[model samples]
Target: MSEKKKGPYKQTGNIAVDMVAACINHYEKQGRKVAYIRLDFIHWTMFKGYVLEQIPAYDLSNGEIEFDDVIVTQGSSLQVKPLYHELVADGKPKVYLMN
Candidate 1:
């Protein structure tokens, strides 16, 4: 989903390296051999009700999806996250979805 909002900086989960492996899986399935993933993020938190309506699979413990890569940004907060990838602070191709 495309997001035109803002949010404060927040990260969730362990930001484990296992997610990288999953991204590799998707890339392999697509035959693109994913070199990297672009995670967009907006400053918005998802409510339980909204999660039920939008992402029922959403795990409150780890609300993020793991793919090839992820990025995080800082801005105003919202009622829900409308973006996916922001940008890795290190400037590397990899992204870590923090909150």
Candidate 2:
């Protein structure tokens, strides 16, 4: 994790994980890969500093936006109790690193 910065999240068309899955399942007659526009944050905003939401829905058209940077929104506080409970109970909210 480098560092969190201010910005809106955008979709990146990188699915190396899906590709690896395809390769692993290719011999089982699965196709190369299906066309899909997977959506996630290019960078989820770090508020007082934890990734809260994937992408804050904005008033933009086309249901997609080209995001290279972002601005900090209000209400950066997170509900810590539930999140800690989830982590302790089931070990959720996994973290990943992508290029």
Candidate 3:
């Protein structure tokens, strides 16, 4: 018999759900709530499909992955990093996924 997979990866067959779940778990451990999620344009092109497909699969009742604001930007690290810092400085709980 096969053993049940642990954590968020197997919770949903969708990889986006699994990634978001893992991110939520990390933020929750730090006593933070994710209100914003940013994906740089290059990665977003590949990732957005998975994310959009899994939006309906999000388990918001658990209150872990509560972010409704998503940002996708096209720019160098110089441009993206500052925006990320600004969000953090403004006390907005955020997750930035970049390559």
Candidate 4:
């Protein structure tokens, strides 16, 4: 039998916002929550290693940013436990990633 591949799946779109949104949406559709996101150097350069709580208001488009890449990981694993970014919302901590 052929085994299915686990991924550091490539997520891409015309803009950084779109790529991020697409990664979140992809997981939501699969009934999985995103645990963390890993950005390639190209994306890291654009966002400067920070992912904002809100999408940017200004156009953050440089043609070079068009193919921005990210890998979305879901579920819990020792491998990913150290990568979570904690967000405190309504006195509750939510774990997600920007690593």
lDDT string, candidate 4, 1-99, tens digits: 012225543443335434555655565566555544544445444443233223344234431222123233222433433223222124457789896
Put down candidate 3 lDDT per residue, 4-59, tens digits, no spaces: 23454445554444444555556656766554554445444434455446464644
Worst 10 contiguous positions by lDDT, candidate 1? 1-10
Worst 10 residues of 4 by lDDT: 63-72
Clashing residue pairs in candidate 2 are 7-70
lDDT for each candidate structure: 0.35, 0.27, 0.43, 0.39
Q: Model 4: runs farther than 4 Å from truth?
A: 1-14, 49-99
Error of 4 at 83 (Å): 15
Each prediction's RMSD over C-alphas, in Å, is: 14.6, 16.7, 11.2, 13.7
Model with the higher TM-score, candidate 2 or 3: 3
Error of 1 at 94 (Å): 24
In candidate 4 the C-alpha lDDT for residue 30 amounts to: 69
Q: Which stretches of candidate 1 lie over 4 Å from their true place?
A: 1-15, 37-99
Point to the candidate with the largest lDDT.
Answer: 3
Model 2 residue 56 distance off true place after TM-score fit, in angstroms: 22
Per-residue error (Å), model 1, residue 15: 5.5
